[model samples]
Target: MLWFKNAIVYQLNKDNLFDTQAITNAVNACPFVPCGNTDSMRSGWVSPFGESQDNPLVLDNNGQMLLRLKKEIKILPSSVIKQALAEKVTQQEQLFNRKLKKAEKLSLKDEVYIDLLPRAFSKYQFFWLWIDTVNKRVIVDSSSFKQAEDILALLRKEMGTLALTPYASDTPLEKTLTKWVKESLSFPPIILGDEIELKDAVEDSIVVKCKNQEINSQEIFVHIDSGKQISKLKLLDERGMSFILNRDYTLKRIKFDNAILDKNEDFLPEESNAKLEADFMLMISQLTDTFKSMQKIIEEIITV
Candidate 1:
C-alpha cells in the first residue's frame, strides 16, 4: 500500500533547486495519455492518488513528494508480424512470378506493423517516484535500472534539467559485504540475513547462490577461500528493515518489518487515502534512518 518494494536511489546535486509547486504545475500539464492508434508507446505523469480529479497531480507531504509515471505500450508480437510478413512475401512472389527481394520484404513488414498496431493489445506499467528534497535524494520503486532511468529521464525533461548521480561508494561494495561475511567487518546495526550470491573473481561466469543458510558457515567459507566474492547479500537493519544489497550498491527486494508496518494498522482499509499517507510517512522516516546508517557503513568501509 504505497510501500517501496525496491529502491534505486539517486543523489541530487546540492546546487539543484526543486520547487515543489513548480513541479506540480509542470507535471500536471503533461498528464498521462494512452498510446494513439499507430503509436508504439507513451509515457507521462499521473496523479499519485489514483485517477481522481480531486487529488493533486503531485502529492506533497512536507518536503517529500510522491509522483507516479504511467507508461502504455502496444503489444505487437514479433512472431505475428513475421508470420504476416512471410505470407505477404509469398503472395507477392506468386503474383510477380519472381522471388521477393529483401527491401520488398522489409517494406511488407512495415505494412504488417501498421495494420496490426491498432488491433494489438496494450500493456500498462506504473512506477512510483519519491523525491526527498530535504535529503537531496530521489528513489524509484523499480528493480530494473533501465526503468528507473526512464523515470529520471522524464523528470529531467519536465524540469528542464535534473542533476542526479546514482548512489555509489568509493570502495567496491562487494569488498565490504565480503568482509562482513568473513567476520572481519561488523557494524552493530548491520545484521546478516540468510541469502547471498557469490561470484568467482578469476572466472566471472562462475557463481554460487545460497538461500536459507548461514552466511558464515564452513561451506560458504570454503567457497570464499577459493576466490569467490559476494555479489549480493541480504541484510537486516536493527531498526526494522531488510533488503538485498547488490554489488552495484542498489537495494532490491526491500521489505519493512511487520513491526514497522503494524504501527499504522489502526488505519482502516476503507480509509484508503489516509492509510496511504500514513504508510508513506512511516516509510520515508524509516528509510531515511536506514540510509544514514548505510552512509556510516560506507565511510567505515572506505577507511578500512
Candidate 2:
C-alpha cells in the first residue's frame, strides 16, 4: 500500500553508524506533536505504520528501513491579509486625516498575519524515507530536491552525524541518454518506454515531450540529430516496474506492475498491519533489484 511515486536518492558514507536501534531511539526522542495556538508550522518524525502512538516509529524489513516525517503548515492567504491591512490602513488614515506611510502599513500587515495565523486552516504533508543499508543508499519520496533535503535535514539532525551525497557520474546523463536513444543501445533489464522529453542544449525553452510513441523511431531521431538532449525518459524494468528518469538522476512517477502487487493479495483487508508489512516487503524487493540494474547502467556509462 505504501509505494513511492517520486524518488530523490542519496548515497550514505561508509563511516556512518546506521543501526536500526540507534535510529529508532533518536527519532522517537522527537516525535510529532500538534501545532500550538500561535504556531504557524510544525514537523517531526512519526510512525510509518499510521499515526498510532503504539506503533513502532521505524520499520525494518530485511535491512531496509522505513520512516515517515509529518509536517503541518498554517494556511493564511496573502490576499486576505493584504485586504485586511488595506482596510486597517484606510481606517487609520481617515481618523488622522492623512495617508499612512509604507513602514506603518508594513507593521500593520505583520499584526494582521499574527492575528489570523491561529485561526487559519491547517494543511498536512507526509514524506516517506527509505534507507537501504546493504546498498548504502537513502531514497526519499518527494517530487522536489528541496523537499527531500528538508526531510533529510531532520533525519541528520536527529542522528547527529549522517553524511550523504547525491548519485552522480563523470559522464553527463543527458549525453548518455541521448546516445542510447539515437543509437538504439540496449541495457539488459532496462528498456525504453513510450514517454520521453527532449530539450535544446543552448535554448532550454525549446522542449519536446512524447507519449505513447516509439522512442527510437525516425521522428525521435530527428530531434536527437538536431542536438536536443534527453532531459527525461521513461524506462521499464524487466520485472514490470516503470519510472521516469530525469537528467539529474532522480526518478519520478514510479509504478509497480500488478504482477508484483498481487503477490500479497491473500492478506485480508481487515489485517491492516499484516497487509502493510507484506506490501512493504514486496515493494522493497522489487526496488532493490531495479536499483542494482540502474547501478550497472551507471557503471557502463562511466566506462564509455
Candidate 3:
C-alpha cells in the first residue's frame, strides 16, 4: 500500500539521541494491542515485519532507520448503546412505579455505556516514519496535522524529550506565498500551477480557492489586493511531480506524473513480501530527494 501520501517534516535537534537500537527497543515495547470488546480504543506501535522479512527495525547501509506503528481502536455504536440504555430505563421506571428523574436517567445511561463497551468493534491503522539522524529530521508519513500529531505525541511518550518543530522558514509562509502570487515571484526550476487556496489572514476563517484558472490573471490579483493570503498552492517540480504546498509547509494532493510512476513499474516484485520490501525502499529513496529539494526551496523563498 502507498501508506504515506504526504509528509509532515520536522526539525529535530542532533542531541540526546544515541543510536538506532534505542529506537528499536522503544518500538518493540509497544506492539499493537487488540482492543477488547468493551474498550473504547487502544493504540500502539508495531513491527511491520512479514514472514519473509521479520525484523522490527530496518536499517540501510547509510544508517537511516524506518519504523512502523499500528493503532487499534474500538467504539460501540451509539444506536446500540441507546437501545440498551432505553430498555434498562424502562425496567427501572416500572420497578419504581414512577417517572425517572433527569439525573437518574443519565446515571443509568452511563452504566449501560460501560456495560456495552466491551462489545465494541475494532478498527486498525498503521503509521510509518523515517529517522534521518544524519539530517536530524523525523519525517512522519501523514497528510493532516492531527494524524501527524498522533505520531509525534506517541514518539515523545516512548523516547522522551523530543523537541521537534514543523518545517518552515523565518518569514511566515502565508506572507511568502502572497508575495509569489501578487508579485509573481516565480522561483526558477519550479513552475506554478493554476490552483490556489487563499485565506483572510486577519479573520483566519475566510477562505477562497481558485482552480484551473490562470494564477497570474487580473482576477486573482483583485483577490490578492483584498487581503487573501495563499494557504494552499499547486506547483510542478522539474521532474513533473505535482503537489499542493500548504501554508504549514506540509504537502498534500501529491501526484507523481505517470511518466515517473511508470518507471518503477518494471521493478515491482511479484512476491508479496518482496514487493513490500522493494516498495518501501523505493519510496524512501525517491521521497528523500524530493523533500530535500522541497525543504530547501521553501526555506530560501520565505526567508529574507
Highest lDDT: which candidate?
2
**Candidate 3 Cα outliers beyond 4 Å, as residue runs:** 14-18, 49-61, 267-274
- State the lDDT of candidate 3 residue by residue for 151-226, as single tens digits: 7777678777678878877788888877877877666567788899889879988988889989888988888899
Q: In order, what lDDT does every prediction score?
A: 0.86, 0.87, 0.74
As a whole number from 0 to 100, the lDDT of residue 104 in candidate 1 is 86
> Is 1 or 3 the stronger prediction by TM-score?
1
lDDT agreement of model 3 with the native? 0.74
The model with the greater lDDT, 1 or 3, is 1
Positional deviation of 105 in candidate 1, in angstroms? 0.7
Sort the candidates on TM-score, descending order.
Answer: 2, 1, 3
* TM-score computed on alpha carbons, candidate 2: 0.94
Positional deviation of 102 in candidate 2, in angstroms? 1.2
Q: Give the Cα RMSD of candidate 2.
A: 1.6
Badly placed stretches (over 4 Å) of model 2 are 94-97
* Candidate 2 lDDT tens digits, 118-234: 899999999898988878889999989998988887877878877898887778899888888887888978999999999998999999999998999999999988989999999
> Could you give candidate 1's per-residue lDDT for residues 1-304 as a string of tens digits?
4788899999988888778876787787788888888899999888777877787778899889999889999998889998988888899999999998888888898898999999999999998999998888899999999999987888777678888889987778877778778765677787788999999978989999999988879998988889999999998998989999899878899989899988888877688778778888889899888888888987877677
